[model samples]
Target: MMDRTDRHCRYFLRQISARTLLYTEMVTSQAILHGDLEKLLGFTPEESLIALQVGGDDPARLAKCATIAAEFGYDEINLNVGCPSQRVQSGNFGACLMMEPERVADCVAAMRSASNLPVTVKHRIGVDDHDHYEHLRQFVEIVAAAGCQRFTVHARKAWLKGLSPKENRDVPPLRYADVYRLKQEFPDLVIEINGGILTLDATLEHLAQVDAVMIGRAAYDNPYLLAEADRRIFREAVAVRSRHEIVEAMYPYID
Candidate 1:
C-alpha cells in the first residue's frame, strides 16, 4: 500500500465507503522527523478515521513521528513491519525487524509514550525461513507487551533474500490460518487479517475469525467493491451512492 494509498487515493476510497477506516501510505520516521512536515503528513478533514503508517526501527524518531501524527489529527499511528522491499530492509526496518522483536517493542513503546492516539503494528505472519506459528506468536506477544493492542497481520511470509517486493506478495503462500490461530491464542488482542482478501464475502468471512479484515491491492484496483462496504459491513441504514454519483462528487477535486 506504500505508493497506492496516498491522499488522493484515500479520498477516492472515502467517497466509496464512509465507514471503513483508511490508512495512509507508509511514511518513514526520518521523513517525518526531517522532511517538510505538511508535504509529508497533510490531509483534509474529510479523511477522518484515517491512520498514518510509519516505517522505522528507531524508537526516538518513531516517537517523534507518532507525536506529529497525533498533532496532525490522525486517528491512529501504525508501525509498518510488513513491507519486504529492499529499500525498507536497508533501513533495518520492515519485515526484517521481525527478527528483532525487542527493538520493535521499544519503538512501539516509545510511540505509545509520545502520543495518546492508539499505537498499532502491521506485520507479516513470518519472515523467510522462520515461517512458523510460534515465531509469529512470539513477535506479536513482544510487541503487544509494549502496549500495542492492535495488530494487522499480513497472512504471508516475506522472503527478504531472493524475491522482489511484488514477488514477495505473490510467491509467499498466504497462511491465513496462522493469523487466525494468533487470534485464538491472544484473545485479548485486536487481530486484523490482511492479504489476498478480495470480495466483500471473503472480508466478512475473515471477520468471523478475526476482529477485522484489511483489504489492500484489491481495494485499490477494483475500488468499486468498497461501495457496498458501509451497508454490508457497518450495517448503516444510509442509502448507498451510485458509482456515477461518487464520480460526480470527485469531479471538483479532479478539477
Candidate 2:
C-alpha cells in the first residue's frame, strides 16, 4: 500500500466506513528516524483506530520508530513483510524476511517492548519456492512467541527473482487455503486474510475462515464499496450513505 493509502485517501475511506480500521502506508524505519516526523507520521484525530506500518530489518531502529508511532497516537504498530518491490529487497527487508523468521521475531519483540500499543505484522504466505503451509506456520509461530498477537496474511507467495512488484501481486496465483489453514492451526492467533479480496461478500467469506479480511487495491479503486461496510461488517444499525452524499460531504475539504 506504499504511496497509495496516504492521509487524503484514508480520510476519504474513513468517510465511507467509520468502523473499518485504517493503516498508513509502509513508512521505512530510516524515514521515521531521519525524516520530518510530522510530515511522515501526522494524521487528523478523525483517523483514529489507525495502524502505522513500518518497514525495516533493524530491531533497534524499528523499536525507535514504534515508540515514535505510539507517541504520535497510532493505535497499532504493524511490521510489513509482504512488500516485494526491488527497492524493498535492496533494503534487506519486506518479503525477503520470510526466510529469516528469527530476525523478524526479534524486530517484533523489540517493537513490542518499546511501544505499549498493539504490535502486529503483515506478511505474505510464502516467498519463491517456500510456498508451503509449514513454512508459513513456523514463521508465525516464532513471531507470535515474541508478543505479537495479530497477523495479516496476504494470500499469495512473493516471487523475489523474476516478477515485478505489480506482477508479484497478480501473477502468483492466490492460495487462500494456505491462510485458512494457518488460522485453523493457530486458533489463538488473530489471523486476517488479505490479497484479491474485492467485494464485501468476498471479505465476509474470508472472515468466515479467518479473524478478519483486508481489502487493498479493490478498496482504493472502488471506495464506495465501503459505504455498506458499517452495516454489513460492524453490524451497525445505521443508514448507508449515498454516493451523492459522500461527494457532498467531501466538498468542504475539496474546496
Candidate 3:
C-alpha cells in the first residue's frame, strides 16, 4: 500500500472491510523527527487495523517515529525498504537500503526497543544492477536477528538509477520464486509477497508457499475483491450482499 497511506485511500479501504488490515504510506524519519509530530502521527485510532510505514536509515530517528506511531495506537509499525522512487533513493532510503542490511537491522532493532507493537519491514528482493537471491537472504538474516520477524517483499529487483518509481514497479518483472525461496530458507519467519498480485486466486496461491500475500493495485482498482476476503481468506463467512446493496450503502459516505 504505497500511496494508499493517504486519508482518501485509507477511508476507501476501510469501507471495504472492517476486518482486513490497512497500512499507511511511507512517511520518512525526517518528517517525524523534524516536522510536525501531530500531523505525522495523527490518525483515527478506531478507523481500522492501521499500521504505520516509516522510511529512513537512521536508527534513532526510526525508533522515535515508532514510538510516536505506537503512541498513536497504530496496530503495527513497518519500515519501508521497497520503494524505488528517485526522490526516495536520493534521500538514501527505500530499495537502496537493501544493500546495507546491517543498517536495516540496526534500524529495526532500534524501533523494536521503542515500541511493544510488532515491528516489520517491507522491502524488495534486491536493488539496482545487483540482483541476487543471496543478497535478499543476507538481508533477511541480519534483520531477523534484530527481532524483526515479519517481512513483506515486493517480488522484484528495483532499478534505482534507470527507472522512474512507476517504471520501477512495472518494468522490472516480479519473481515470486525468489521470494518463495526465502520462505523455504527461513521457515520460522513470517514472509508476505507483494508486487504484481492482482486477484484473490493469485494471493491465495502464493499463500500456499508463504505466510501471506499483499495485494496493492488490484485491491485499490477493484475494491470488491476484498469484500470477500473476510470469508475466503479468514474463513469467516459474511452475509452475502448484492453489489447494488453495497453501492446504496456507500451513498451516505460518498459526499
Q: 212, model 3: CA deviation in Å?
A: 0.5
Please give, for residues 1-255, the per-residue lDDT of candidate 2 as tens digits: 888998888888888899999999999999999999999899988787799999999999999998999899999999999999999999999999999999999999999899898999999999999978899999999999998899999999999989999999899989999999989999999999999989999988888999998999998899998999999998999899998888888887778
Q: Where is the poorest 10-residue window by lDDT in model 3?
A: 39-48
Residue 75 lDDT, candidate 1, scale 0-100: 99
Writing each residue's lDDT as its tens digit, candidate 3 over 37-113 gives 66666766445688888899999989988888877888899899988888888889988999999999999999999
Model 1 poorest ten-residue lDDT run: 1-10
**lDDT winner between candidates 1 and 3:** 1
What TM-score does candidate 3 get on C-alpha atoms? 0.93
Writing each residue's lDDT as its tens digit, candidate 1 over 149-237 gives: 99999999999999999998898898999999999999999999999999999999999999999999998889999999999999898
Which parts of model 1 are misplaced by more than 4 Å?
A: none
lDDT of model 1 at residue 106? 100
